[model samples]
Target chain A: MWTSRRRTRAALVVAALSLTALTAACGGADTAKTAAGAAGGKGGGAVLKIKDPGNSGPLAVAKKEGILEKRLAEVGATVQWGGSYASFTATVDAVRSGSINVLEGAISPVLGYLVSGKDIKIFAFTDPVTDPAAPQTDGLVVKPDSPITSVKDLVGKQVAVNKGGRGEYLLLLALQEAGIPADQVKRVYLNPDQGASAFATGKVDAWWAIVRAYPEAVAKGARVVVHGRDLKDQDLNMQAARTELLTEHPEVVRVYLKVLQELTAEAQKNPEKFQNVFLDQGPTAVSGPRLTDEIARTRYAKVPRFATAADGAFVTDVAGIFQKYGVLPTAVNPNDVIFDLKPAA
Target chain B: MTLEKVPLGVPASVKDPVEASVTSVKGPPKGLTKDLANDSANDSANDSANDSAQGFAKEDAPEREVRGGAGATALEPPRYLGGRRRGPVASTAVRVLVPLLLLAAWWYGTASGAISSEILAGPGAVVGALGELVATGQLGDYLLASAQRAGLGVLVGGGLGLLLGVVAGLSALGEELVDPTMQMKRAVPFLALVPLFISWFGVEETFKVVLIAVAAASPMYAYTYLGVRGVDRKIVEAARGFGLTGTRLAFGVIIPTALPNILMALRICLSVSLTGLIAAEQIGATEGIGYLVTLAQQYYRTDYMVLCIVIYAVLGLLIDLAIRGVERVAMPWRGQVAAR
Candidate 1:
């Protein structure tokens, strides 16, 4: 009984000391989380909670190491991350529901949100890195020995594509180029994971794969019928933010992009460090060589910058393709969605 | 899997209510028993029922020796009065050997080209990944976070369920008021409520916790309701005849008689909480076993994916063992009866 009381006393003392130290640290000048509700600080500070993109990039490394959070703190801004989602649709929904304010995604879904009278915008965009040695970010994968070699050959074939997503977008682009009508092919609407299984089990003759799916299919010897890079200018990766947040506190977005730029450069120099962060920190089955190659393909593409008018044309061209295919009733004007925070460099 | 005849000297231990009770402890409630009769019968097609009914295993043309225990040592006129205990080492070894054999098969599959690294990681890769999580201290942190979420969820949900169950089981008004709403909730899939919950609670701990609570509430309510309702009507009448009335009769008779089912409800609720955790932690969770799954899935890391599964399986085993311990402590009569 005596020892138990003594232990409790000692624990209380330690906790008290720790609490004091923590308060002192947190109340320091650089702490951005210090909400100025009645404290009367400038609009430069606000918490920017964004969606996490899971465990395969420099951003993931930032999440694990508190790199982005630390950078935000320096700029008198705080950052919180929502859960990683498997679908960009979920992430967009989170933004729509005000669960999160910012998301890094393809321009397609964000366009839908904008078209639906949501006050969202594309603040930053990445022009696709189209090098010959670049890893494919998206692909219409077929069996190695399949007779189908190009998009034109997809006529009357059962092709798996994520409905109204990058997979469908890529297939639509390729099919348009080959002068084949979208109705000629059977579009099997399935998600990436389902698409992978379907493509492998002979359930579908071809699967338009994207992001993680493309590399996994390639690893399994799925021949590429059409690569994202092969589509020329259609594949523009982007980071979108709600215009409400942008108008209210631009600093949060600014600090976020600044940290991403640094991490993007860091990932380029040591792609393995960022890509395999999950392996070193926790358990993972990352194909190191494949991920490193993927990092090269995506690293330069993630360099944070304001989009030029020419980059907006890709959005217009994509809209035109979707409109021509009659998938979307009308095209989203690039001007309405692209909120250029800075002039073209 | 057929058992031998009683060899002329063996005790009718299989006929004991103690062994019978254990087999039927997880059985369907009284209302569903008629439909489940074929499934529970000795010659049933249900392998799950057969495996769990250890003492009642097919008593046909037999090759059975009292497994892991000394049998028929006193096989004369007076049989052994009490149940013999199994050899712990032997039983545990058999249990441990199953996964080891599976591991061996997995190793062989990977070592050959039969299973590609893309499809599945080797055992070595998974072990290395486990080591990495341990090294970074992520495994412990994630486990603690997940446990806290599940524990809080089960406590709140199970408490609410128990209250409603007892009320509905005892009175007609409660059945009308609470049962219908609970039944409606029970029918709705928790996945369908994700968007609404996020909108209501935001993508934070509140959302995660609420989602888990909602998932845990239904099964707990079902099990507890069945348990309380299964309390013998005759026992209540007997207590009333003795002038025991109201809360007095309930505390002294109905609840005590229904204790076994309540304990079973606890076990089921605990297991259901894990499922809720997986669904809840999919969105906005920073640290948890489920988040590990999200990361592993995102990175397409089969090693981490398998490791997360192992973590869950181990957690489930621990939960089951803990409940068994509780059952042993709470129902000491069980041991006494089984010993006969």
Candidate 2:
């Protein structure tokens, strides 16, 4: 009985070992072949790998209109839209990993990524909040009946932010500009949903939120205490690629940027068409009024000719704020990180 | 050897007259046949005694056989069947092998360029990041903060759970009052209570700690209640006969018997407490292992993220091992019985 059992166990072990060996060999070969194919294909032509941000943004609109696909097709290349990311960080991670080739996110996170030694470069500026005349996309809100009427009133108060991101950066800048010391106010990190809820219930003295949440806050008897635009000029959003991608395929990058610039220009010239495309193709469910309001507020810029002093200064200032708030480990020069890719004049 | 046939209903001493005549013809003594018959009876009585002895041996043979089998199996047991007689070095080697293989695979994959460093960092990078975090004192501070929250949560939650569990297990009325409410609460995932907890406790240290406590409580209550309820009634009666009563009866008879379950519950509660701490910290924390992971994730620093995860894993394993050590010391008899 013992001999038979031992024999059977030995046979099972041998079978398992053989199977594992076979599987590993086949899997390794397949992975190598796939990697080679991907590299060859990328070298031959452009394959624009973009992440779906799961928002009704320009990328979503371009996807809906097939603008990117059409433009890339003209160059005999293809565009591959990857799965939607859960957050800006997730998108950046995907891009950094080369899973996605391009990511569109707010400038704050881009700077944050740069400071942290992620090899990413800005290729285009989209949705600039550069126009000070424009209504602010983000603001600091407080309950209507609250005694806090200004940003300085936030001192010794518990202010909630989406934290360690754009909202926190803006809040810190606003607080500094208001001549309030950073240590005086307590900063609480909450997601947008929680921040709004906290603001409504008076759990937090103030909330830093985007314009999309403004209507809901207002309905809950919250009023804007300070606007983010009031502190400094800000870029609402920008598109970036891995620095390696830029070095390897500058032409492809330029072509892609050119298409984006044209798309921005087209959207600006035909707002109604742009709104309709977004309404038709965007992932979000939007009322006509809200869609119109968002479209009216959005201001897209053509690809910048070069990294301006202002752009460098904006990043430098935000990085300083990040360092001050202990978000960044050390101060880094924004000029060193921002790559200016220009379309043909 | 054949004996002369005796007549039915006759005593062994009273042999047949015909058999006696035959024996005389064979030139044997007249009383010899009677004596032989008596000796036969004595031998029959001895045979019955031997049968009883055989029965006793048969009853005990399987237990001895089982012990022998257990000893043999213990020499090279399967990894999953944790029990006695495993060599310490072999057990440790077996335990460490799988994780080492996993680390090797990760390293190989990264070095071979199959696994991108961006999405998942190499083990070396993660180690370096851990070293950096340690040197900067960030890891120590974060770990300390997280540990404190989890520890406080376990103390408060585990204490309450033990009290409630004892009450419910000991008294029928207590069970009716508390068991139903606890069951209902257990049905809801603890993380779902974040919003409500925030509203009630505010997004402060109190909120995070309470979240961890609430999460840690349910398993403690369940296992402790089960442990107490499962105490042998015979043992309780025996203790009562020995003059144990009331609190003394519970502590002496019930608690010691139920201690294994309570310790098991504590292990489970500690894990849940850590999970709760991470989730709660993610919501509104500026410092902690969870917050560190979040910061790393935000900056796409996979090494830092992985380091925090490793720290959490190591912390959990250490806590579990500590509880297991306590269990071994507390329940020495369990180990002996299992070994046997």
Highest-scoring model, DockQ: 1
Give the total clashing residue pairs for model 1: 3
Worst lDDT window (10 residues) for model 1 chain B? Answer: B42-51
Q: Give, for candidate 2 chain B, the lowest lDDT window spanning 10 residues.
A: B1-10
Residue B292, model 2: Cα distance from true site in angstroms: 27
* Candidate 1 structure quality by residue, lDDT tens digits, B203-274: 666677777778877877776666556654545666667886655555576556556667777877877777
Which digits, one per residue and each the tens of the lDDT, describe model 1 over residues A1-345? 543343234333433454465456436522533443234235447777777645567678888898887887777877766676655666666787776777776776566666686577888887667566656677888999999988889999999998777778888888877889889999998878777767877799999888778888898888988777777547477877888888787767877877788888787777766665555455443556675666676555547687655577878877777677776778888888787666335
Tell me the native contact fraction for each prediction: 0.31, 0.00
Best prediction by TM-score: 1
**Candidate 1 positional error at A213, Å:** 2.9
Point out where model 2 deviates above 4 Å: A1-43, A53-55, A74-77, A126-133, A219-221, A234-236, A275-283, A299-306, A343-345, B1-340
Q: What's model 2's lDDT at A93? A: 50
- At residue A229, what lDDT does model 2 achieve? 62
